[model samples]
Target chain A: MQIQTKAVNGVLTLSLDEKRLDSKLAVGFKDKVGELIASGNRLIVFNLSAVDFIDSSGIGCLVTCLKLMGPKGKITIWGLKPPVESMFKLTRMDRVFTLCSTEEQALQAVNS
Target chain B: MNQVSLTIDSRPENVPLVGACAKEIAGQSFSIDKLSEIEQALVETVNNCIEHAYCGSEDRQITIKYALSKDRLFVEITDQGKGLDPQCLKKLTAELDYNPSDIDCLPEGGFGLNVINSCMDEVNYRREDGKNHWSLTKFVVPLT
Candidate 1:
């Protein structure tokens, strides 16, 4: 999995360039999120526009990123497609994270 | 053959393939309950192997075996890594002090073994021949 990070208006936009996030890629992705958190970027916008699938481990990684950010920080998701959205709904995690329609909307939500 | 075997690399990208294999069998008519249980347990168990089993190794493989019968389905997943310590598992189950707030603190990814234990009718673990062998079973619930 490849993770690219860009910051605009205090929102750290993380684009995941992979097809899925399961056990195999969770750790590496977790570390990247950790790095962002450690870098004092409290507001996060995850662009999963490229991710087509996500298992529990993938969801776990995102949850861990949120926990790592603590209560004062926020992480939002944008462009969640089919199976990944199904997963979030199955676990009731869609209610937990901020879900936006597009990357631009996600950045706006976080920036605002 | 009594069972179907699938080989998956230790990479996270194969999670869907593993899930699809299990789901194909479990997602028949009115199999939602079973699908939910199997998906949760399978992901948790497989994630355990992926995140902790081979922790830092890149050349290892995780082998998954599936067996279906009229009454129950059996799943066995094996990983090429240092086996887990029974004593540590005992400690994890024995101690209930930590609040399950953070995802990383979870023993098995998000839902952890608790979900596996709840979803599957039986769960067993053993270490043999330098491999971690974890087994899970679920009985097909009769139609009401």
Candidate 2:
């Protein structure tokens, strides 16, 4: 799982460069985000434009990443395709994470 | 009915193979959206078996049998680990009753069965002859 990261202002954007975020990549994804949070980058935006599929484990991994960030840290996700977005909504994770339609919106939410 | 059976180690690395098999089998009859849904449901179910059924034990084996007919697609996932808990099934089925309102109260896990149930037309689980059998069926009207 290759995640591209960029820093703008104070927020770090990590773009998922994969089509599927299933069991195969969930642990790796968590570890990468965990490393980022451990390095003092708390405010984060997950750009999932390229991802079209996410299983329950993938969703669980996202929650694990959020918990790893602790209380002071913040993480938002944006650019979810319809099918992937439906998973979040169906699982009620849409309420758990700050979801945005675009990267700019996610950046704003994380910065605010 | 046309059927294909695949047996793989209970490891995360083999999940994509299962997904690919599902897509290839289901794509022969269903639409793109339905194919995606079937693949997603299969992935969730198989991943659940890997995480909970086998408990991260890669030495175990998981078998997936897919049968496609004119009106329905049937999938059976068999595992040799511990059987499914009725209580977990009850909780997962109950989750479909309402949507949570608070972000802080959102559940991080326990959504695997729900995703499977929501995607497939029929979901059944039973312990038979010391193996856990998960049966999933999706109904589709064949394109004429």
Q: Looking at the true structure's interface, with contacts defined as alpha carbon pairs within 8 Å between chains A and B, what fraction does model 1 recover?
A: 0.28
CAPRI tier for the interface of model 2: medium
Q: lDDT winner among the candidates? A: 2
Per-candidate local distance difference test: 0.75, 0.85
Kindly report the docking quality category of candidate 1. acceptable
Candidate 1 lDDT, B1-144, residue by residue in tens: 257899987765565666678777655532765665676678777777876888745567889998877777889999988778676465323423333445344333434565567567888898888889989888877788
The reply for model 2, stretches above 4 Å from the true place, is B96-105, B142-144
- For candidate 2, chain B by itself scores a TM value of 0.91
lDDT of 2 by residue, A51-104 (tens): 988888889888887777777777889999888988988787887789999888
Candidate 2 C-alpha lDDT tens digits along B1-144: 999999999888888888789888878788877887888888888888888888889989999999988899999999999888877787546654434443344466778888888888999998899998999999996677
| Local lDDT at B112 for model 2 | 84
The number of the candidate with the highest TM-score is: 2
> Candidate 1 lDDT (Cα, whole model)?
0.75
Chain A TM-scores, candidates in order: 0.95, 0.96
